[model samples]
Target: MHENEISQIVFDSGLKIHRNLGPGLLESAYEECLFYELSKTGLLIEKQKAMPLVYENVRLDIGYRLDLMVERKVIIDVKSCESLNDVHLAQVLTYLKLSGCRLGLLINFNTKLFKNGYKRILNGDVAL
Candidate 1:
């Protein structure tokens, strides 16, 4: 599936999860729920997938992990915090770069409104 299509499904799943379980939950809780919801759609998803970093032609297992990688095309960074900061955005962007994916979704489940908590991040200078 395309990244945008997968993203739409993710948004819908996130909304359903947020509505059913409101906020104040842990990130792992939301991630598990989201993973279950997405799994039902028959899409391939990797949870807590470890990522290796390469520096100066040397590969290092720096313990970077993606929260969820959907279909190997999009990365989903699950967050349940007071608010998403620049670090979160940078984290997703870094994942996209490392995975060579074009799109990423940063879903923060600790908000009064679900829509306000999600952000679509592009890998490069491409418009959203």
Candidate 2:
């Protein structure tokens, strides 16, 4: 599937999870639930996927990880913070660069409203 399609499923799944569980839970809880919800869609999903960093033509396992990678096209960075900030956006953007993904979802499940807690980040010249 395309990144946008995968992203829509992720948004729907996240909304359902936020509505059912509400907020104040740990990030891992929301991540696991989202993973479970997305799994039902038959889309390939990876949780806590390790990412290697390449510097100066040398590959290094620098402990970078994506919270969830959907269909290997979009990266989902799950967060449960007081608020989503620039750091969060930067993290997702960095992951997109490293993974060569065009889209990413930075979902922070710690707000009174789910919509206020999510952000869509695009890498480079992505169409959507």
Candidate 3:
């Protein structure tokens, strides 16, 4: 499946989770629920994936992990905050750059309406 398709599934799964659980839960709760929901979709997913930075020909294993990687194509960052901000957007972008992925979804589950917290960040060829 394409990255866009995988992204849509993730978004749908997130909505389902938010509707059932409501808000005020920890980010991990939503993450795990989303992970479980994603699992049933039959798509490949990696939770808390470690991401390293390679600079000056050195592979540095800094502490950075993608919240969830769907099909190894889309970087999904789950956030539970009063609102989604630039930092959250930058986070997903940084993950995309580090992982060499072009597409990502930033889903903040701390909103009255789930759609208001959804964002799609892209880099590389897709950015054009």
Candidate 4:
């Protein structure tokens, strides 16, 4: 499937998780719940995926992990913070770049409405 299609599936799954779980939960709770929802939708999802950072031709086990990778095409970062901030959006973009994925979703499960907390980030100059 195309990246856009994968993104839509992830978004829908996130919405379901948000609707069911509502707000005021730890990020890990939302992460696991979203992962479960995505799996129910028949999409291959990976959680807490180990990501490596290469430096000087040497791979370092820096303990970096992706919150969620959907279909291995889009990255999803789950957040249960009080509010979505610039750092959160930037972090998602950085993850997309590092993972070589074209798109990412920053889903903050701290708002009353899910729409207000979902932000899409695309790689490089690409627009989503």
Candidate 5:
């Protein structure tokens, strides 16, 4: 599927998870709910997917694990922190780069409004 289509699926899944669970939950809680929601929508999803990191032709497996990957087109990172910072965006961007995905969603479940916590990050430097 296209990136936009996969993004919409992720967005809708987040809305459903937030609607049912509200806020203040841990990142793992949101991840579980989101996984179920996405699966119910018939989208192929992967959770806690380990992505190996390559540096100088050596594979580093310890520093990589994607929170969620939807339809193999988007990376989804779940966070339940009090607020999101640049570090959060950067982390998602790094995940996008490592996963070779052009689009990513950084969703913080600790906010009062889910919309305020959802961020769409695109890898401008990488060819999608």
Candidate 6:
């Protein structure tokens, strides 16, 4: 599926999860549940995947991990903060740049409504 189509599925799943369980839970809770939900849909998703960063010609393991990668194309960053900050956006964008991902979904599960927290980040710097 294209990133747009995959995003609809992921967005629906996130909405369902948020509806089933209100805010205030740990970010990890939402992550695992969302991961399970996504996995059940048969989408390719990697949870807590540790990916190395390469600079120039050296690969470094600096503990940067992707919260979830869907279809190995879109990067999903799960969060439960009161609201998403610049750091969240930067983090996901950085992931997309480093991983060569074209799209990213920054899903924050701390708002009363899922629509209030969904963000689609595109890696315009890297040609898709």
Q: Summarize candidate 2's per-residue lDDT along 1-128 as a digit string, tens digits.
A: 77778878898999999999999999999999999999999999999999999999999998998999998899999999888888888899899999999999999999999989888899987778
- Residue 16 lDDT (model 1): 100
Residue 33 local lDDT, model 5: 90
User: Candidate 2 local accuracy as lDDT?
Assistant: 0.92
For model 3, residues 1-128, the per-residue Cα lDDT tens digits are 88778878988899999899888899999999999999998888999999999999999998999999988788999989998888888888889999988898998899988998889889755752
In model 2, how large is the Cα lDDT of residue 106? 92
Q: List candidate 2 stretches off by more than 4 Å.
A: none
Separate clash counts for every candidate: 0, 0, 0, 0, 0, 0
lDDT of each: 0.95, 0.92, 0.89, 0.87, 0.86, 0.91
Candidate 5 at 119: error in angstroms? 0.4
User: Per-residue lDDT tens digits of candidate 4, residues 1-128?
Assistant: 88888878877877888888799999999998888888887878899999887779998888889999988899999899888889988888878877899998888999999989888888889865
Query: What is the alpha-carbon lDDT of model 5 when measured against the actual structure?
Result: 0.86
Q: Give me candidate 2's TM-score against the actual structure.
A: 0.97
TM-score of each: 0.96, 0.97, 0.95, 0.93, 0.92, 0.95
| Model 5 clashing residue pairs (backbone) | none
- How many angstroms is residue 7 displaced in model 4 relative to the true structure, after the best TM-score fit? 1.7
Give the CA lDDT, 0 to 100, for residue 43 in model 6: 86
Please give the lDDT score for candidate 1: 0.95
Ranking by TM-score: 2, 1, 3, 6, 4, 5
TM-score of 6: 0.95
Of 3 and 4, which scores higher on TM-score? 3
Worst 10 residues of 2 by lDDT: 1-10
Better of 1 and 6 by TM-score: 1
Highest lDDT against the true fold, candidate: 1
